[model samples]
Target chain A: MIPVLGGSGPVIPSFGSGSSCEQNNGWWCTDWLREHWGDTLQPALVQHIELVAIAIAAGFLIASVLAIAGFRYRLLDVPVGGFADFLYTIPSIALFQLLVPFTGLTVLTVEIALTSYTLFVLYRNMVAGLRGVPEDALEAARGMGLTRVQTFFRVELPLASPAVLAGLRIATVSTVSIATVAAFVVPKGLGEPIFIGLDQNLFKTEILAAGGLAILLALAADVALAWFARAVTPWSRA
Target chain B: MSVLADQFTAHTFVDAFRFIGDNASLMLSKTGQTCELAFAALGIALALALPLGLWLGHRHRGLFLALGVSTLGRALPIIVLIAFGLTVLGVGFWNNTAALVVLGIPPILTNAYFAVDGADRDAVEAARGMGLTERQVLLRIELPLGLPLIVAGVRISAVFVIASATIAAIAGGGGLGDIIVNQASYGLAGVIAGSLCVSAVALLTALALGLVHRAVSRSTTARA
Candidate 1:
């Protein structure tokens, strides 16, 4: 029988009747959620966070180095930018599967795919942000007898903070969403519950809960990063 | 041992190609389905979003709405949307199409709004000064000037829809994703081949749209 919400409501015990809900394939069961919160949901949330964090952190580091290098050697910019764009074009699922032969069905494969996806956004932003630093500011730093490295750190880096953080914000939120797909291979993260629910006759409660959490996490990360960007770049506010 | 390992690795690549060749009709059909799903979603999203965005932009209003819709759209995962659709809409083509439409809307809407809104205000004023009707001002001045950004939004939406369409298989919708997800039936080579096809399609879509963007921008600039 196709399970319809409230279809079996009058016959079955309501609310905390977890067994009935499970049997009838009810839309949501709060009792099942409460039971699984500790063992299932929490760990999945934690893993989701870990996956996003590691992917963004690694992506930032790599993109930063590439962006800086591309800036220093203008000749390198085209190729590096092109490469990142190429990587960005590959869909997450395809990228994940493409790596499975080399890395197997491990977290490493997932991370590699996730990290590659971030490179385009992070690299493009970093390059644009750094290049966007005002010539006057650079001149002032040079006139102050600051070394190139010192000038970059004090003047250019601060000026570029807004763009860099904007990139981070975008990358972080996107990675959060993409990392859910990672669960297909590695069986970790919020996606774990989502796929589990899908496999188990479309468990509406689990899918909704996990999917809701993923969306919330993305928005939270976006807001936090936006605030952090504004905080770091006080001059921009003025 | 090293030689044998090298041969084995080489064989896997060759095997993947052979698999694709063997399943040429199946892969092509799946790819066609993917394109159909993506385009249908894009078309619906455009029909819905463009008028709203254009009207808002013409009036120079609702900046927050445009940006908010986009940000929220990006933050919402396609997989989650599909899963949600499955619960409410049930498994099938419509569910997948609806999820993909949500995916396609934001970029196009925001871009359309911003493109028109950010058009050369002086040109808009001049058009008004020349006694062009409001419709003429919008169609001739704002839209033409904003064509590049609007097209960019379309391009972004197209790529996103195409990529996310792969997950339609999870919702009992057919696409190359069917091959990727059904690894037991399709084998490792088939899975890899499916992924390769998806990547190729995505890259090609991006490239083709990019050329269109360039051509449109160039014509717009030449006219100016």
Candidate 2:
């Protein structure tokens, strides 16, 4: 099991290698990466993924409830949106630090901050998608003796899938990027190496590796989500 | 100095407010530095993105590039960008400023481009029919029409720069982040105070620019 905060050992252990790249502080040290890939880099990547997954999952659940309620009662839309906008305006770093007094320096603090960031994008898109469902389609469903629940499931949701999936794409990509900052609060995710490298005399190799992996992960998630959206909404392709 | 130290030891919200009060000068200076860095970057970003966005948008070209830049910008984390800057540019004001300028560019550029490109084609044609040169049409017509979105773009970038500027302190750049990051010296109350200040600056910037956006759009619509 991955060690939690204050207990996790030094992120980058000193290898004390006599290699030329290590001595010269080269930007991309292949030798160092090959040596620490499993013990260091891989775990950081896994932790980063876990942070993003948990935050997005939690954010999606909350945003869905908010979106549905806002859609049912249009009056709640302004206040709910205003709250999300308020959350979005706060920087990730500041939000994390602000939570520390309440949640302490734990993964929960990091996740709470990360989850809040996702709500604006996710809730906006979900509501827009639901509202964008054609009125005629809803009417047809009603004429066919479909109940409100059935009409929503069979008609509204599928119609709104494109916008909702688009929101997920954006929320996922951004959450991946923001999750790196969570390291400043909890010593987990790709940010750990980036911060550790900064603290450890600006270890060039570790910083580059971790930062590069984060960018790659975001791009990959974006592409995968785009593809998934297409695959799920086959009718939209036509 | 001893009194300041005692205030820094604050733990509760009231104590945090006291810390801000005692360190009023320090807080003010840090807040000013944050504004300086944020505005400097925003200025540079506007100068660079506005003209380019305007030109491309006027010609109805480079849609792909405009959208791609914003998408790429969104995907790249500001912290990682700052780390990269530290490696190449070394730690200083310019390093932080440059990273922030990159952060600010995409939104402004995308909005500017769209703002111009999406201006009413019929109005544009009508202007052209009245013997306006392409430059005149662009400057007189598209720019006014797109002003709202451009302002909105600036509003977004301003908020981003102010918020991200807090992290510049980690790279030896002076800002409110200094108090927050050096928790051992400033204490938890100081850190909270700094965090509150950063959020306040960011929210205020957004609010101010939001007013600008509304005003610009309102004036433009009234003109129409």
Candidate 3:
């Protein structure tokens, strides 16, 4: 086990040499990273990515199903959007507390909340994309004797790809961000380092490194997603 | 029943009310503090983002910049920003507010830029042709045309800031979150009470702004 940090014993601040090293190092140092990477930093980063990946994947799946349902039944859009917005309005901390008793401090609790957060972004974008498909294109597909399913898969889906890609990028970024707070619920990810940094008064280096890494992760993921979007939607350039 | 008996023996709503009543002063101050943090952030973000976005959109430049910023801002998590703020600036109002200000900026900037960029081109050209200076054209035409989306952006930021301000308590800046965060000592009733207040405030703020957004867009559409 990679030391959960808080369940038992007093928090032993073992990573760094001392405050003097931090002060001398000034904010972020390569030396400090080398010192901690094998044990603390790498694991936290991996876990952070894992949490974000799982939540976003799960969220995208659920949102896709819901979005399709809403699109198929126009009346479902209102209630679906409203419910997602309601879930979005709930403060993250409160949501965690509300779930902790029932879920008892599990990753499932974090995933549920994180997944719920993605629905509004994903569903709205998906619906909008589907709706925004040019009517002429749909008509042409029908004129070509394509069935509704064929028209949808060939004409509508390709047209909707850009919007869906945009939604996926948004959902991924937001999930990465929110998963940081999941440390409070379960001591897993960069959040663990953050809380430990705050609690242990290991202020400068630890928090900076952890927080900076999280930001970097987000930026990197975003850039990658944007690149992927462009590559996948080659027609968008024209 | 005696006052003490009544106070001790209470249901969830009664306990919630008692928690509110007992900490009435703290709740009020914290609520104000949270509002100040959120509003201050919105104010600063508006000051910085609006003009830049408007100018870029007016000149038909910086589309890439605007897009990059919106994407980047979404990627940066609120909690990490808060942690970074605390590390860089120490635990204070500035630290908490800085994080929130960053949070509020992208939507306002992106919307403002797109609003100007997407304004009716013919109206803008006509205004310019009819002896209006660039500044005047922007002020008289683009600004009005863009007002609906700009306000919608602010509304989004405001609601987001209000909801995220609860994290300020964790950062040691007092807010309604203080109640929920301190639920260890304040108990389950305090959590329920504080959460209700946060949710209500978030929903109410969003609802009010939503109404304003609709009115602005509706009037603009009517004019068009």
Question: What is candidate 2's CA lDDT for residue A97?
Answer: 73
lDDT of 3 at A201: 58
Q: lDDT per residue, candidate 1, A111-189, as tens digits?
A: 9999998998899999999999999999999899999999989998889988898889889988999899998888899
- Considering just the first chain, candidate 1 attains a TM-score of 0.89
Worst 10 residues of 1 chain B by lDDT: B1-10
When only chain A is evaluated, what TM-score does every model earn?
0.89, 0.90, 0.88
Against the native complex, each candidate's DockQ, computed on alpha carbons, is 0.34, 0.38, 0.36
Give the higher-lDDT candidate: 1 or 2.
2
Evaluated with DockQ, which candidate comes out highest? Answer: 2
Q: Which prediction has more favorable TM-score, 1 or 2?
A: 1
Question: Between which residue pairs do clashes occur in model 2?
Answer: none
TM-scores of all predicted structures: 0.90, 0.88, 0.88
Better of 1 and 3 by lDDT: 1
Clashing pairs in 1: none
